[model samples]
Every structure is written in structure tokens, then in C-alpha cells.
Target: MSLSTTSLRSPRVVVIGAGVGGLAAAALLARQGLDVRVIERGQQPGGKLSQLAVGPSLLDAGPTVLTMRWVFDALFERLGQSLDEQLSLRPCAVLARHAWGPEERLDLLADLEASVTAMADFAGPAQGQRYLAFCERAKEIYDTLEQPFLRSQRPTPWSLAWRVGMSRLPQLARISPFRTLWQELGRYFPDPRLRQLFGRYATYCGSSPFDAPATLMLVAHVEREAVWQIEGGMHRLAQSLAALCQRQGVQISYGREAREILLRQGRVCGVALDQDAPLQADAVLFNGDVDALRQGLLGQPLRQAMGGRPLTSARRSLSAVTWHLQAEVGGFPLSHHNVFFSDPADEGYRREFADIAAGRLPAAPSVYVCAQDRTGDPMPRHSGQAERLMCLVNAPATADARPLTEEELLLCQAQMFARLTQAGLKISPSVHPLQRTSPQDFARRFPATGGALYGQASRGWRASFQRPASTTRVPGLYLAGGSVHPGPGLPMAALSGQLAAEQICAALRSTRRWQPVAMPGGMSMR
Candidate 1:
């Protein structure tokens, strides 16, 4: 059962979970001539990025907007392919619209000068200049940290120190890593409206701007770099990646849940499926929740260690309750993405995160609406003609025993509709609930404790290192995705997969005695 270095067998890589991370890792290893097998519990690939059928309209369940296009470009380039050849991406002129109250709207345009001018007109001239300055600082931080920390797997303190030292500490300090994002913005802009507007970026990683480090301002820079949407839907990107993996000679098994990480002696081994069959491998990369692995997918002896001192302590991020609506409305002044802010922004945010931490729901929650088919397309209606809408509200990630009652749903729906109507959206042609994913449902779907979208909350200075590394105490085990280093979002998760692949490749290369088995069409045998 031992896969010794001297053995003629090719390295077998078992990647659990068909998420972006798992798929990316499998594709990378397959390109390197490794025998890679992907096992997913779901009926199809793409964890959260999968598509959902709502009547005839196709809606993307996760990550509508795509940033960091270079990441995907690089991944495809590595495999001797171009992303353009596989899929088409359309650049959004208007990124998103933010509303403070009734008759108040601010559109974040793709053009920097236009956005700045809009801010000046809406808020003040000083706020506009401050935003420009913020963008510059964000670009600097992104450029300085991109290669050394973000692209690499297991960024040690020494590596970070060296990179920071090389960049000159003064420039690094200018990014304002000490203060919270909100605190830093407040320093630059006197207007409270401007601060609240920019503060919303913290939720990009499921964090509160009041608590996340000012370094997170890089999110704005990243977005400005390029904001795009897939031609058909975001899920098409996942489908393309999965297709690329299959074409590269990687084997994918759907609806096969990995029940255990079968270890031989104290080293790496393989995996056992729920069907009671063993799939052997030289290395095992888990793209599922790290907490699940630590909880013992193997059962028994594995269970003891799974609960043992966690490698990293994590604070769950805020969960959301999303309502997918199908309705008929004329003259809906909204793009693909829109946000409606409730009164007293700080009060609402505090109630959602802080009050929830103290065990309570927010008094007034900020609601976000994403209208996918606002352009008005004909055909495919439940009863008659209808459009698709995704309404989300920021809620606490507490696992309360109380289930959502029908009355609660009606009340929330009424409040959301009122807010939408007040914000200049005509919503009087009968709206039907196509689907509703609550905090409990998110928890069940993703198995994120308390349904926290982001793996851990980024609060204190130590929070950066709070993320677990790719490798664990168990020899062959490795982690990838939102839970691991570099954190969440589509781009970060993709980077995690690349990092894990690098680690696995490096580990195999170190064993010079092992030779890859040659097969036809650039494939390898295990």
C-alpha cells in the first residue's frame, strides 16, 4: 500500500470537493502528467458556483462579478489554452449602484474620473479627492503583496518580513494596516455618506468594515482593475473550467462523497468513498471545509484527532438570507447589481454583526438586490411574463434553533418590497418567490459553521495568520479554498488551489528517485 519514492507508479492525486480550488488543483496536476481524480458529493461539479434553474431563466448562485481576470488567464495559459477561446466575458460599465435612502442613488462607474466626479457631486469635492488617494494606496498594496504572499502557498512570517522590508516599511505603513477600514476612510473623508459608501467593500470577504483592517481597501483597486460578467452566466465559467480539466485527462467522479482519508502508517495514502470502495493516491488535497476534515471524515480514531486542538481558531463571518424573486415590473432603474441601504448605516451594521455576537438580530438590516434580467426578455414565465431578482439581507451567522416562520417571511418580503419601491423600482405586477436560501439553509448547503460565508472573521492583527495552511499534522493531508490561507472569494480560492498544487508538486519533485509513468496523449499512469 506504500507509494515509495522508488516505485514506478505515477503520483496519484485525490482531490476532494469539486469546488474551484479542487478543480484548479486537478487541472494543474493533470498538466504535470499526474494521475488526478476528483471526488465530489454533489450531483455535479462547481460547489457554490453551480447554476440554479428558476423556471426558464438561469441564475448564478455565487460570485456574479468576476475580478482578477489574470488569475483565470494564467490558469488556462498554463495548460496551453486561452480563456477567450473557451468563454467570453463582458466588461460592466457600471459596477454597482448604491442607495442611501429614497431618491438617493450613486452609481460606481467603470471610469475612475467619472466615479470621482459623481462622488463630488453627491457628497463633496474633498471626498472625491480622498477617494482618488485611497485608490492609489490600494494599488500600491496590491502590487507590493501580490507575488510574495498572495501567489505563494504557506507564506511564513520570514517571507512576509523579507517582502515588506524589500518594499520599504514607510510605503507599507502608508496603506494603513493598523486602523479599521471605516476608521481609515473617516480620516480621509469628512462626509459620513462617503465613508458608508466605501465601507461596504468589507463585505467582499464577508467582513465588517468597522472591524476589517484598512489593508482591505485593496478590494476597491482590484474591482477598478476589471469588473466583468460572463456572457451567459457566472456558472458558465465553472463549467468551462471543469470541461478544461476533463480535456486535460483528469478523472472526475460526481456524487461520490469521500468518507475517509485512508492513511498508511503515518504518511500520506488515499481516500475511501461512502460506497465502501478505496481510491488510493500518493497525496490527498481536500477542497472541502477544513473543519470537516479535522472532524474526521475517516471516523473513530480520526474523530479523536479531528476535535483535537484545532490548527487555527476561526471566528465565523456574517451569513446572508437571499430571496430569489420572479416578478413583472416596468421601468426598473437598476443594472445587474444594486444595494439599498437602510437608515442609520452604522446602527444597522452594528446590529447585524455586533448585536448578533451578543445574541440578537439587527433592528433594521441593509438589503441588496441583484436583478439579472432587468433588461426585459420575453418568454419563459411561471404564470405569465416575469423577470428574475435576487434580494439579499445581511444577517448574523448564529445557529438559532428557531426556524423561519411563514409570517416572518411575509413581513421581511413586505419590508424589502417597500424599500425597493421607495428606491424608484416599480414592483406592482405580482412577485413570486422562486427560492429562498436562509442562514440555516446556507449552513446546510455549505456546512460552514453558522452558515458563515467567509471562513473566519478578519478582525485583529493576528487574524491574517489565523488562516490554516495547506498542510496539516497528518502527513499527506492538504487544505484549499475559503477556509485556508489567502482567504475567500473566487480569485482567492483559485489562488489557494494553485498554492496547494505547488506544494504537492514540490513535495513530489523532492523525491528524485520517483519517475513519472509515460502514457499516450501526455497522460500519466499511477
Candidate 2:
């Protein structure tokens, strides 16, 4: 049963969860000529990036905004291909429009000078100039940290300290790793409104502006560098990735739930399906939430390695409540992206996290709407015809705290409609519940997620390194996902997959001989 004694050669990798991370790993490994199989519990692949049908229109269930295009480009380049051939991406002229109050509105243009000009018009020229200064500082931080930190899988504290120490100590102060994102903004802009506008970037990863570190200002650099839209929808990117994986010879199994991780003599051997049939593999790469793997999905042996800590047992990132509307209104003078801020942004955030902890709903919540499709334009139809609208509000992930009561659903729907009306989108449309992925639902669908979209809450000082590493205590096993290193969002998830694949490749290159151990009675070692 020992992996070292096994006579097998050539590692066969079985990846559980065919989401972005899993697919990315599978594609990379398969390209490396390893036998790779991807199993997904959902009816289709793509995990959170999957598409849903809303009447005649299609909606992307996750990540409407596409940032950090280089991450995806590099992935394709690694396979000796071009992303432009696989999928067409349109550069967005207007990143997003933000509304602090009904009277106060600002548009973040893709053109830096145009954005500064717009800010000058809205706030003042001084504020506009300050914004330029702020962006310069953000760029400095991004340039100094992106390669050594974000693009790699080195998460050990000592590794971080060494890297920071090597890069002149004064540069660390310039990055503002100690101050809150809001506090940093305060130092740059004296206007409260201007601070609030830039502060919205914190929510990109579902953290509060008041709490997230100033280092998050790099998010602005990422968006301003290149904001893109897929030609059809964000889901098209997922579809393209899936197509690429298929072309690379990856075996994808949909609706096949993995019941356990089968181990032999303390090393990863294979996986057991829900039907009790065991599929043997030389190594296992988990693309799903690692916390779930450590809990019990892979059975007792994996759980024991985690010291009985439930992955969902920890505090999670913010959850969202989204509504997909198919309405009859055309030529709507709305941008591709929009954020309608509720009064007192901090209060709304406080309510969301508090409700998640206590199991309740926030009274007033900040809402975001995405009307743009793959073309960075609205859906084309007859003039005055209704268009599709995707509305989302930050909410607690725990269903027990934010139950889906009939009255509560009606209230939320009504509130959303009223807010939309106030924002100037006049439309009475048929609403279809394409999908309602709450924090509790996230835990159910992504067991290791603990209802957290980004795996762990990025609140503390060590939060950056708090992201799990690819290598685990169990030999021949690795992890890749938003919950792991590099953190969440589409770009980070893709990076995690690449890092995991690199680790696997490195392990194989050093070991040379691949070993597959036998399972006794076809049961998990748990």
C-alpha cells in the first residue's frame, strides 16, 4: 500500500472541481503530457463562472468585471497559444460609474486623462490632480510587489519578510501596508466624496474599505491598466477556457461528485466517487476549496490532517444577493457598469458582516448593477425594447442568518426595484431567479469555501500570507483555487492553478518515477 514500494510509473492526476482553478490545472497538466481527469459536481463545468439562462438572454453568475488580463494571456502563452485566438476581449472605455448620493455621480473612464478631467468637473481640479498623484503611488506599489508576491505561490511569512527586506525598507512604507485603504485615501485626497469614490475598490475582493490594507490600492492600478469585456459575456471566457482544455485532451466529468480522497500509507493515491467506485491516480490536485478537502470530503485521514477544523468554521468574506432581470427598455443611457452607493457606506458594510455573524439581513445595502455584455455595450434589440439587467447587493453568506423567507425575498426585490428606479432605469421586467448563491449556498456548493467567496477573510496584518499553500501535509496532494494562495477573483484563481501545476511538475521532475498505491476493500483510508 506504500507509494514508494508501488511499481507504477507516470503520474495520473485526478482533479476534483472543474471550476476555473481545476480547469486551469487540468489544462496545464494535460499539456505537460500527464494523464489528467477533471471531475465536477455541477451539471456543467466552470463552478462560479458558469452561465445561466434568463429568458432569451444569458447572464454570467460570477465576476462581471475582467481585470488583470496578463494572467490569462500568460496562461495561454504557456500552452503555445494566443488568448486573442481563443477569445476576443474588448477594452472598456468607461470602467464604472459610481453614485454616492442622488446628486453626486462620478464616472471612472478607462482613459486616465479623461478620468482626471471628469474628476475635475465633478469635484475640483485640485482633487483631480490629487487623484493622479494617488494613481502614481498605486503604480509604484503594484510594480514593486506583483511579481514576487501575487504571481508566485510563496506564502510563508519568512519568505515574505525576506523579499520585503531585500527590496529597500523605505519602499515598504511607500506601499502603505499598515494603513487602511480609506486611511491611505485620506492622506491623498482631502475631499470626503473623493475618498469614498476611490475607496470603492476595496469591495473588489469583498473587503471593507475601512478595514482592508492600503496595499489594496493596487486594485486601481490593475483596473486602470486594462479593463476588458468579453464579446458575449464573462461566461464566454469560461466557455473558451473549457474549449481550450478539451483541445488540450483533458477528460472532463460533469455531475460526478467525489465522495472521498483515497490515500495509501499516508500519500495521495486516488479518489472515490459517490457511487463507491474508486478511480486510481498517481497524484491528486484539488481545484475545489482546500478546507472542504481537509474537513471530510476526502474522509477521516484528510480531516485528521486538519486537526478537526471545519473549513467553513472560520469567518468568511462577504456574500452577494443578485437579481437577473429581463426587461423591456432599450437605448438605456447607462454605462456597462454602475455602483449605487447607499448613504453612509460604512454602515452598510457593518450591517452585512454583522448580519452574517448574527444571521440577519442589512437594513440598507449598497447595490451594484451590470448592464454591459461581452461587447462593452448593451444588448442590441429594437429601440425601446427591454434589455437584461444584472443587479447585485452585498449580503451575509449564512442562510441561517439571512434566511430566504417569502417576505424577505419580496422586500429585497422591491428595494432593488426602487433603487433602480431612483438610478434612472425605468423598466418593468419579468425577473427570473437564475441562481441565488448565498454564503450558506456557497458552503453547500463549494464545501471548503465556508460560504466565503475568497476562502479566508483578508482582515488582519498576516491576511495576505494566510492564503493556503499549494503543498499540504499529505504527500502527492496539492491545492488550487481562490481559497488558496494569491486569493480570490477570476485572475487570482487562475494564478493559483498555474502555481499548483508548477509544484506538481517540479515534484514529478525530481521524483522521476510515479507511484500508484492500491486501496483495500475499495474504501478510503479515513
Candidate 3:
């Protein structure tokens, strides 16, 4: 349950990218008495978790909601830090507002009973019952996977089964890892709208509902457990964690890019930076997309470790076209989180999936709007001047050699706002200042990613297991971030960091070079 090793000097650990995963690993390893240094190319530490500015507006550029908060609690608790003390979080009363068309609107609430009541009123009594049952099923799947697949680092189904023990094998069927999430929803809700509603869970990992495994249903339970609105922006959480890392003696270097992963006899020894001299380290934890490692972006030598054939565009996840606007609100009352679904809902997703699959932007796409001003209440519009608002529409990955043209984007933008208006929501473009970020922009910012938002797409049934693991074949190299193991989203990304840290601790312990160290997530090494 503890790690022990003999060493006179502290082992220097270098983390690539200051994304949540890198920051988490750096913080935990530093706490364990390792000399940890984080390298980032950007001005801030959040990576994709950070905020962006469009003229006068500071908007959340990436993820908006914070769910599975316990993952963060466990992380900070390891360092004897309090998350509540460090950051201000407002629990979302209404998780998110969903609109299908002019007459159909639904709100998923933080309170499960309230959501069920809303569903009853929106759909029918039968749907309300089905929703309650779906919640139970979702929780069951979540409970079944929590300790084994999510928390533990296991490579194959056999390893996962071994960790779960023989008794828990039947529960695999309980989680229904065999079916697509969209197909599985048909069993719970007969309403196509409700099916698409719950099936939306697949998008949580940046995969299409028709393709992502039903195991993603756990996302529903994850959301129901907690959804907090970070007071300033989601990036504030990253800033807070970076500050804590500094307090723990972890050195953070920004505006410096990692050019190549220095290797010694097929094991990681250090990293070469773009702006500075090479940094020598006992081990390296990479927090960027594994694509960087495979594409030889770091170095040609590291490509073999990435495994598999070259990643094609077909393997990427759905990207998005985003709008960050400082505007005034009107029409339907805005909530903290609002999702405007495409009317003739089937028409929206069908075209979207087909277009993205064919590597083209969807003409009509579902839009997710985050009204930053309306966190707990609808802000009174004074002269229609409100703070920042973020509008996001799912798009194909940045696969085209040429960017999504302003012409193409203009068309998508027209559909985006149009869907909002048809769904009882309205925003005046003339009154607002907007910044558009196409998938091409995302790809440019995060290199080698086709602007695929949530790491790799979780496509086939085996994809859940196919993601790169924390412990790789390379002895001193490790992987973290949403793309690895436990899968995407804020909490999942943090867990990936914890897992990488645990592996590093275990590796150091086995080498007999460090003192006995107890791992995170209540895990202990023998």
C-alpha cells in the first residue's frame, strides 16, 4: 500500500502541457517530494480549459460545466488543499435547457425529481416513468464501472475483468458495453426526442450517439451527481490549481513549447523545448493528445511507442464552430446553460453525423449556448447590454487542407442563430460583438488535432479500451489527459492525471529510489 525507494537526490519530473492533466500530475508528484516542472506554450496554464477574450468579452473558450467534482476533491485532498477554499463554484439548479422546436422545450435540472416532473409535463406520464427508470439504469452502469474501469488503470478487457474479479463479470452486461448509446436509449424511452435527449450523452466524449458505446451512459449519472458553474470562468479552476502547484513547489514555465521528447535507450529521460535549453528529467508525463506522439511532432523516435497505424481523419472526433459574443439578451429567458436543438431533430443529427463523417460541416447543427451573465438568475437587460455569451455548434474535424471558409461558416452561423430563434431563443447580432472560432482555428491552436474536441473519437465498442493507457511500453514515459484511459471531460481528464501520477509513483517505488509513497484515489502500491 506504500512506495519506498532509496535515493539521495529528488527525481526531477517534467510534465508537457499545463492542461488540467499536466497540472494535476505536477501537483501530486511535487507533493511526493519530486522536483516537478511543467512546460506550456501558451500564456496560461489551462490549455484547453482556459478562457479567451474577444475584444471586450472574456468567454469560456472550451468546456463550460464542471461535473464529477469528487475527482477534483480527491486530487486536492491529497495535497491537503481544499477545493471550496480555492475556488468559488455555484451548483447549477437547472443543469441545462434543451429546445427541439417552437413548441417543445425541456430543462434537465440538478434536482432529479424536478427534472422528472419537467419531463412529465413536457412529454407524458409514461415518459416521466421511463426517465426515472433511465436514471436508475444510468446510476447502475456508473456504479458498476466507477472502481474498475474508471479509477483503475487496466489495458485490455481481460485486465479490466481481472481487476473487477470474477464475481463482477456479470455486471459487464449490466453496464451494456456492447450496444451503442443511441440504440440502448430506445429500450428506455419510446419518444424520439427523449432518445436524442439522453443519447446526447455520447457527445460528452465528442463521439456521435449512433457510434459511441452505451457505456457512455454513465455521463448522465456523472452530471446528475454535480454540475457547478465556476464563478468567473471554467479557466479559473485551472488558474487556482496552478497557484496551488506553485505553493507546492512545482515550477511552471509558460510560453515555452516542447519540441522533442528526449529519449535514452528507448526510455524517456528529458524533453527539448522550443524556446529554451533541454530539460533533463527522471520521467516525463505527456498531457497533449497522443497524436503528437504518433505524428512524430515531438520526435521521430517516439512514433513507435504510439502503436497502431497512422491515425486517419475518420478516426477523429467531432469538432465545433464556436461563437463568443458580448451581447444583450431577449426573446425567451436565458438560463446559465441553454441547448438549442435543431427542429425536425432527426434532420439535424442525421445531416450532422453524415457531414462530419464525410469530413464536411453540417448545414443545420445543434447549438449549445452558455449565457455567462445568467448564472443563478436572468439578468435584467438594461439597454440590452449584457456580459459575455458563448454559442457552440458541433462541426466536422479540421480535416480539410483549407479552412472552413468564411463563406461556409457564414452559412453555419445563419443556421445556428436561426435554430435559436425557432426554439424560442433570440440574440441580436447587430447589438453584439462576436468572435468566430471554426474547427480550423481549434486545430491550429492545438496542433495535430483536427480540432477534434475530446481527444480521439470513441467510435467502436472496443474504442473505450483502445485509448492509450497511462503506463506505456516505454519505461519512464507516461500519458495523461482526456484522450487517455478513463475518457474525456474535466473530471475524467483530472483522473487521467491521477492515474499517470500513480504509475509514476509505482515506477519510482519499484526502482527503490524514493521513500514509501501512498498513491492517490485511495490506492496503495504493494
TM-score of each: 0.91, 0.90, 0.94
How well is each residue in 128-234 modelled by candidate 1, as lDDT tens digits?
88888878888897876677667765566566767678647666667676789889877776766667667778887777888898888888888888788787788
Backbone clashes, each candidate:
1, 11, 6
In Å, residue 435's CA in model 3 sits off its true spot by 1.1
RMSD (CA, Å), each prediction: 4.1, 5.5, 2.9
Q: Model 2: runs farther than 4 Å from truth?
A: 1-9, 164-167, 311-314, 329-332, 345-358, 374-382, 400-404, 431-437, 448-450, 514-526
Rank order (by TM-score, best first) = 3, 1, 2
lDDT of 1: 0.73
Candidate with maximal lDDT: 3
Question: All candidates' lDDT scores?
Answer: 0.73, 0.72, 0.81
Worst 10 residues of 1 by lDDT: 375-384
- Model 1 residue runs over 4 Å out of place are 2-5, 297-300, 303-314, 330-332, 345-348, 374-385, 400-410, 428-432, 515-526
Query: Tens-digit lDDT track for model 2 on 1-526?
Result: 2234435544678889888888888888777767888888898777888676787777777888789998888788766678899887888777887775556778888789988998888878787888899899999888867876887775575676567676555676677777888888888877666676677777777666777888889999998897888877788777777777888788888889888888877788889998857888777888877667656767888777655364342356666677776766432356678787665545554454455445444556567878744233332224455566778876555553344566665676677666666656576676554444455666677765546566666665577877788878888888988778887889989888888887777777566464223322211111
Task: Write down the worst ten-residue block by lDDT for model 2.
Answer: 517-526
